[model samples]
Target: MNKQHGSHEDKAERYELKQTLSTLQLWGIAVGLVISGEYFGWSYGWAAAGTLGFVITSLFVAAMYTTFIFSFTELTTSIPHAGGPFAYARRAFGPTGGYIAGAATLVEFVFAPPAIALAIGAYLNVQFPSLDPKHAALGAYLLFMGLNIIGVAIAATFELVVTVIAIFELMVFMGVVAPGFSIANFTKGGWSGQDVFSLGAIPGIFAAIPFAIWFFLAIEGVAMAAEEAKDPKRSIPIAYVTGILTLLVLAIGVMVFAGGSGDWTTLANINDPLPKAMKFIVGDNSGWLHMLVWLGLFGLIASFHGIILGYSRQIFALARSGYLPHYFAKVHPRFKTPHRAILAGGVIGIAAIFSDEMIKIGGQTLTANIVTMAVFGAILMYIVSMLALFKLRRAEPGMERSFQAPFYPYFPAFALFGALVCMGTMIYFNPLIAAIFAGVLMLGYVYFRLTRSQRETPPQNEVFEPSEELA
Candidate 1:
């Protein structure tokens, strides 16, 4: 009788874990994770950062990304729950901090889909010429929703396949563009204000800093797949770090080879930057330009797919814990994917089309404001997560850890500091932009507090006691 009861408990636990994620699926989450941050939206307004600024921003952000991936992997493995940052904060900090962490992630995950889908529209306009950016953006998002509704397995497969194509394209661009690279093109001063302290190009480096941090963003999707991974401990860390490393290499290569030395004349007209660089280096007839555009489009498509794939999981996770609407927790019976939440993501994308594509502020983008808002929101979440990590180590020393953030206080501290600097630069150069960013986060907090007060009780009966893992 005792043996049978123990077996049943094991089976129940297995079933719950099975619903989380598998290794391959986690890989999909990993690749899809960065679409909004850089891979999807890379072209939009980066030039405003200028060439030297852009290259500097890209390299600096890549380092930050690698460090954070390490941090997240450590936290994810320890928590083993669906509510990623929430679980980490709860473990490291107290429940209140956990709620705030969850709140910030909610903002990032919620806002990200639209931010990405909006980007897809911008590029599609260049491709089709006749296509409206808004329509193209909406069409792409609808397709992503459809695929996600079909299944995660399919979605993961798509993410893997597209990431492969993107990786190859980046490699080809480096291999071809390396020969023509001009060293002088990269260092040219941009948008000058001689005051070395200013944020224009120098200061812009700080303000535009967030623009450069693209490597392996969507990889947070791995956390969403926590229930789906075959061996959550081993698989998540391997895929998480490896995928981030691969992206970092590609990002750096593009910076070196594609964005390398060129005359301001050649660089000035370079709107479709990467594709134009490849064509410039290899002659368009090599059929490489077509391939570059296609690959970029595919990567962009993959990014949107990832947005739906990754963020819906957040909804599923929050819902399962009773922190969000239970409908978000529902997985399709036939597909085993979160169809309801997948559609819910559409709300933000559609809103972006209305707000940015439709309305303009001073003949400039509400879109630009949206982009800055996302960066601030993501940074806020990063801040909460890092502090939570420090707290987690103090409380959860007894918990089994699959991965540890390297250099102890070094990497996490620097990453948090970098995140702060990035945010400050962004706010300083673009306060109207920054205000929009801070406003969104404040709104979320206000909403959460109001909702919590009205409910009168916490979401779940579960009590999360602190572990001994504090630093």
Candidate 2:
């Protein structure tokens, strides 16, 4: 009787999330997590670099993601922790490195959603001019946070449906805009600031990296779902490879069509670039225009909802490991989701919505400001993660590996260098935002030092083993 009672207590303490997600659903989460990037943020590249310059920039950024995802797959499958990069870095670099990786990841997952939420609001305002974007943004937060807290199965299912619709809409968008595609139009002002072959054009290409990165910004978010994935060893590789390819196709298609359709400048900075691009291709009165506007919301919703799942898991992992307040680690006994973490993140996102409205820098809106800020965080995390991969490869050579990155050192080294270059270029271009990001990292480190150590020894409540493996 006592043994059974102890076993029940152990299970409760584990906070073990049910592994209900299959490969298709994992693919949905991975793709949905980043599909919104195709719709909005990448256009900003045109502002920094002309149409051709942006395309050039995107090719390099694509290379980085391709290599990084391959290397990340090995660590994620072997470690298979909800902490994602935090877990991998922790294993590689001790507490300080782990904290940096975790903090950057928090910034990436947490900061990403507000931008998507704001885009959702912008899409709504297009339909109903009277509605305030902020109100719609806040409403989305509340509704989705509740859904996330309810259950991962339900939330993931919703993600799958919306992701499918969003993919279809992009296809329809490409079809509508295809005939209008003009090589001359696409190539207009293709090089901005300097000639392509000149040394001076390097800055323009580097500056455009962030916008190009928007195309695949959160694709690595697939790693965050490792804990919930049904057959992580098998499903993760398939999802990562397929997800990046899908985004690559979508990214190139959208950038070319939108760039060529009109004065790319017109849509360069707006949140609803696709709808505006539709206006240029088919004119304003086309029936497809209205449908695209409404359907575009699904793309933003897919990302916003998907990231909520990611941030909550990050929070749960940190809290469970004692890097954060224990409160955030608590799972809802009924739903078995991290209810506290979800609500806490929602509150932060709501605050970010209002803060963006109140703050502006160098004539850039709060939305642009935060998007760059999130990129700052993401690159920092990427630098650490790629290094961790190399470090672990040398340090623990015999670690069990279900999947290995194709190229040993070169792939990860290139990814690491590219991430560093992007970070340096962004800092040179946006010093103030870089300063703010640096301050946040410093403060996060200070807090980590003061916190109790969960790294030295595993907590009794933590479960290091999977509850069940895929057959």
Candidate 3:
């Protein structure tokens, strides 16, 4: 009796995550997780493909994400687990597929924070010239992780507040830059640095795939918070559909306004593109420039803080499934957060920030390299997730689906095709980063194989069950 009671207590402590997120909070998390992309990373696409060329790439990627979220929503509402793609793949393809999906997600969530943190640092540097961006980045990791560890409700409330401000600041940026916007400036040398578009621009378009993807890269991370959502079936769909629409408008608006304001090439290859673009229109000493520098940190903060939430849930989910050390699965007794997993992800992010100068690949900055690596993970997970969607359709047709993906086969199929194309193009353009991504997966698989016998059986919550509505 004592043994059984102890086991019950352990299970309770290990699996609890407070279901406190509302639709607005979920929307906040959905948008917050990817909004930073608009502030910084996507400009690098202009470096690779020029303004018009990158515009084409962004539109294509935007289409891919639109379709992907529609299809992915069905799975989230059906499963409603913190694992997101990891849980879906596990249900459809069992342990190995789960490992692949989980590992890919870990890569995506883990690596993305460092890049955003560095951007936050860069934004801070614009205000405080003497501060080291790396040090600032490290401080960001520490501060946000503590916030996340405090509790889900607190973390999500903060996300909502900051995301709203970030969105408003972006609108402010567009309004302030509108007077200087010139079509001639936007189109000049806009096709892979050529004045006109041609078939010759194809290579640059392919090379720009990852940076273009940055715009909506982590929006799907909303799925990670589904388990913690109140009435996930109703809230997930609303948050996801609305969130994608919001991001698409902001991405196009921000990109066009910035490109048209000045020589687009100057905005490329920098972390603080919005402020720099504003400086062209407002000058170096303007209040508008200072406002952007200060408020801009909110965009980076939203993503950095939200992703820290995302990575911890993924780490906790993976560990609970016996794919990682059980220590990571522990929920804090008081806070109800995955404290260990949060800290673990933080350590990796800090290490990447420290290695910014030490590690070089393809002559890209640390931000660029990590962004590419995260994109590789995201594309792989997307492919596997769409496959899981198809598999579950056949395998469990009767499962309760609160939200069915519109267009069914067509929507998922298009998403799959786009993911495949992006993955192939990314590999062609970034062979070294692709190899490093592969190496991480291979090492993870080896560990799985070696520990197969000792692995614990997954708890009941890790498995899917039809909703009571179906019964």
TM-score of each: 0.84, 0.95, 0.97
lDDT of candidate 2 over 126-183, digit per residue (tens): 8899999999999999999999989999999999999999999999998998888888
Provide the lDDT at 274 for model 2. 92
lDDT of each: 0.64, 0.85, 0.92
Candidate with best TM-score: 3
> lDDT: which is higher, 2 or 3?
3
C-alpha displacement of 181 in model 1, angstroms? Answer: 2.1
Instruction: Kindly report which residue stretches of model 1 are placed more than 4 angstroms away from their true locations once superposed.
Output: 1-25, 35-49, 190-201, 261-272, 279-286, 357-367, 453-471
Please identify model 2 stretches exceeding 4 Å from their true place.
1-14, 197-200, 453-471
Model 1: what TM-score?
A: 0.84
- The best-first sequence of candidates by TM-score reads 3, 2, 1
Strongest candidate by lDDT: 3
Candidate closer to the true structure by lDDT (higher is better), 1 or 3? 3
Off by over 4 Å in 3: 1-7, 195-198, 458-471
